[model samples]
Target chain A: MKFAFLILLTASMALAVDKIKLVSTTTDLAWAAQQVAGVHAEVRSLLNGTENPHFVDTVPEFIRLVGEAHIVCLVGMELEIGWMPKVLSRSGNAQVQPGGKGYCEVGSAVTPLEKPTGAIDRSMGDIHPAGNPHFWLSPKALAQASTAIRDALVRVDPQHLADYTKNQQALAKSLEDLHQKNMARLAPALAKLKGPAVIEYHKEFTYFFDAYGIKSFGSIEEKPGIPPSAGRIAEIAVAAQSAGVKLTLAGEYAPSKTLERFSELSGIKAERLATSIQPKGKNKGYIEFQNSLVETVLAALSLN
Target chain B: MLKNRSLLILFSLVCFSQAARPEAAGTGLQISVAGDIVGNFLGTADNRLLPREGEVVLYAPIDQTWDGALNLAAHNEDGEYKFEIHELTIGSSRLIPRSRFKVGQYFLGVGRLNQTHRHDWPFTSAPKVQTQFLYEEGVNDTGAEYSYLWPTPFYLDLTLGITNGWTFGHTHDEGKGPVLPTHYLRLVTYNDLFLDGGLQTGLNYLGRKDSSGNNTSLFGLDLTAKWREAQTLTFLFQSELWYRIYSPAAGDVENTIGFYAYPQYGFSPSWSLGVRVDGYSVLNSKDAGGNNVGSFDYGLVPTFSYKASEFSTIRASYGVKGRLSQGAVSNTEHFLELQAVFILGSHPAHDF
Candidate 1:
């Protein structure tokens, strides 16, 4: 009789301490969710830092992770449209399905940039018609996303509403401060750049450049997500030189040789930046990620 | 005063219209199409260029609880185009706890390659074993399936399904229904091999009774493993082994076993090389003297692929098959095949 009572007591304790499980499609969102849900929820991310969010393998492990989640946070606006739908459909978890209380799309908080205004098709090379979904690069956008994620958490765990709300306020303040500090530091460098500041490999840095008041003249690839021909590269080099572009920037995953040839033709330096934070590596959080981007761009422009 | 009242009423009408809108943004039919064009040299080939298979798929959520898909497929046969309804399924993962179900017509969850669309296959062609035991592509029929994932330390999934067995294999003509419907059970498990690697394995069983009172039972084992570094696949290995028992109402019961093994290595993000070996055997056969003999055959194929992007791929393969009769080589055939696959829009993610 004593042993039975002990077993019953242990089971009740376990149930009482059960934590909410949250799954995010990207690492940045996972970091934000962890900040707000601290000690009250378990947060997991699907992709590590290095992967291209556009094309992801629909691995079985994702299904398992999402199946046990109370909330599934994703960067919406077609950023994860390729694989997230498949994962959600196979998860067999009703709570996280679309229209459910736990289906959280944090991207809805931000007003996206470069949203297509007219009819668009594949001729443009795998474009997201809704907008550029890489809004996390901008500190202001990430703060908005954090607020949206906080609301989602409260809907699922109303008992912890005050805690989440207070945490979100702190996070938003920190991000705003970081944004102001970086802009002030980069103000002198921004004044020195010519008509157009940089030439990028893809449109990944649109929000980043906008935040810092940097003007981008062109992209190495004539079309997004498509490898450009040598002729196209040569044309871009001529146009960039005439436009007085100062630097070329690309993600590490881009073709190194192409960037090298473009740099040679344009007589400008090229810099490769980490597109996302490496939680397990050097850049461990969102703040480090933003700092790395600013430092890399400064060094590339010979301003630091 | 009258003009003011008219303006207020118009404003309320506009507000009511906007509020009454029921459909959410971005909820529309997702349409995708894929096609495969193949050319064979050093063997009997088609007179002209023709697509091996062209498929158009439409999918959308029926409501908050259900989603539906319709697949229309066309292929060239005997220098003519034939169109058919490949699959039409309505499914939902939210209907039960840790469980999902789909009803209508779909490919059975059996071996590794059976459930995957052929256009999405890494290689150019199906194996000899798969073609002999199953259809050249796969077996698709009207079916209902229930899949459940058990709460365990590791990933374990169980699937139970039943299909109307009107006919077996690929056929153009409608036939009489079978005496018993096809039933299948599959159990799959997955494990992380390393930080960037995963391995999935499954065991499957399918059985049916034909109109002639003959029973056919198939048992299958499949394994798939992949390892990636820096967002590029470095190694992939897929294999499947199947054994079939054919019990005739009046005759000696026969059995057949077959297997295919494929291993691929990625040279770069856009380039990969792979080789596939196929082995098959009939356990019981009769010679001219009515002696119980066995026949075995094997094929070797090496393929290379270059993916221009997610929407297009180009592949080339060389294959050679050898048939063994009574411990003696009977015949050999060789072929060089080239294939191109393209996707037009919103391609669904392939299952792993």
Candidate 2:
């Protein structure tokens, strides 16, 4: 009983620590937030790593978490397009609103892919209309997101600025060192590849391809987010055959049917690629996700 | 003048509250209240047979998991009736599985021969046979059912269960209990075909036991080929064969056999048109009611249904019973129905 009292006192003191309560929209942000906040903050990600971030429900439990968060971070290049606006208004937390200091967007500080060049329409199946928000699939993209979060944390609580800086510097150095090693190992294979364009099931690999001086010929999705039309698949089959594009990287969550149809039509083998680290077996986290990308690109080169 | 001033004050209060608490304005709480604001402008003379006709359905789902749900509704037939607690236990794991069980008047697993709600005859008429043996297999029940959804490319859902069999929307006196044995088994399947087409198949079984240990059974099967994005050709064949043995009610019990089949087509996204010809017999109830009611009977039911979206549907169906039609009493008045559907607290949102 006496020991229990001492434990309770310690626990209360720990809970009373100067806390920055954070709610991350996705696992990557949760991971990035931890890099800066360390033990000085409490962090939680609203979405499961396996679920499509765009389709997260406005569950009551989710609302309660958002209500208590001192800060909220999201990959803002329209990744959370359908969810953020509604959740923000419903959160009743002015500190985490769009223009507030607590609202930190990961992508505004980093570049986005396939930004809409014109006005939007709804024929597209749930495209963000702003830009592809899947930029965190690359190491550089992950580092860029951390930098943005660091800047935002600096604004929110200047008292913890030094601590945040030290954390960011340590994280950045380790990330750069790992990225260099992987690049060195992968440089030879990337140079040997003579493919005209890479093919993918979804529009998730543009940043990964761009980092390695590669170009994606087209997406198997006849339209963005829309399942491939029969005629479109037939057309792509012919183009792929002629263009000698042998690499088809299937997104971790893409339908197997689409990949099968593409493979059967094009006579090219397809490779499965992880979009996020999840479900235990697949590579997870920002770093592991980036490293696993080399296999698909290499597979296409090997086929050639 | 007094009313106008009150209205002005109310409207101002609304605006002032919204502005003052903008952050909390759009925050909708988990518990919400919604119902169909129904308007029945067009009515037939037959509808006048009822003193009143309007229903307000109220539902509260346990959560997004759909692990449990309770629904209540007031259908003012005589005055109004309550929709007692309807429970459904949904499972994500394979060992135990998903199920929809209720201890109130509810729908049975048979209508799932066609899972789309709009496909039911006249949109809301859930087969007369279902009502004969059981007042409703479509609303609430005083029984429990266990369902298994097999993890396969072919989406096959299997269900089996036992219930209290009484259908007054709730369980009543023990003496009133028929000790009616209720057992139900059903299966439905779907498979991807070609570039566009798909296949659907279904089967069902139901057995009832009396207090004296007498038992009756019903069985069925259905299949369909969906070729286009919104079109399907379906074929159905069902037989209700019963073993008329072991009843102490000393009345000359007889074995019965019934069969049914049909082919139908869906013409548009919102409209499905079909025709069904079916027949059934009883182990005992002969032509006692009227009109050459042979143990074997059949009917050609041509149906037209429209599902507006995932949430609402309308249907109209008509049929002519032949001479051999079982339960043949008189030419019945058909129906055209409009129904609104809403998945409460938790519904699985399909992701691409």
Best by lDDT: 1
Please report the candidate that would top DockQ against the real structure: 1
Candidate 2 accuracy as TM-score: 0.50
Per model, kept true contacts as a fraction are 0.52, 0.00
Error of 2 at B297 (Å): 26
Q: What is the interface RMSD of each candidate, in Å?
A: 1.8, 15.4
| lDDT of every predicted structure (CA atoms) | 0.84, 0.56
lDDT of 2 by residue, B216-332 (tens): 555555555444331122222222222223244445454554444545565543567766665555545556664343554455667666655333345455655544444455443
Per-residue error for A204 in candidate 1, Å, reads: 1.4
- Give Cα distance to truth, residue A275, candidate 2, Å: 0.8
- Taking chain A by itself, what TM-score does each prediction score? 0.93, 0.88
DockQ for every model comes to: 0.44, 0.03
Show model 2 residue runs off by greater than 4 Å. Answer: A1-8, A11-13, A124-126, B1-352
Q: Candidate 1: where are CA atoms >4 Å away?
A: A1-17, A241-244, B1-27, B229-232, B290-292
* True-vs-predicted CA distance for residue A300, candidate 2, Å: 4.3
Best by TM-score: 1
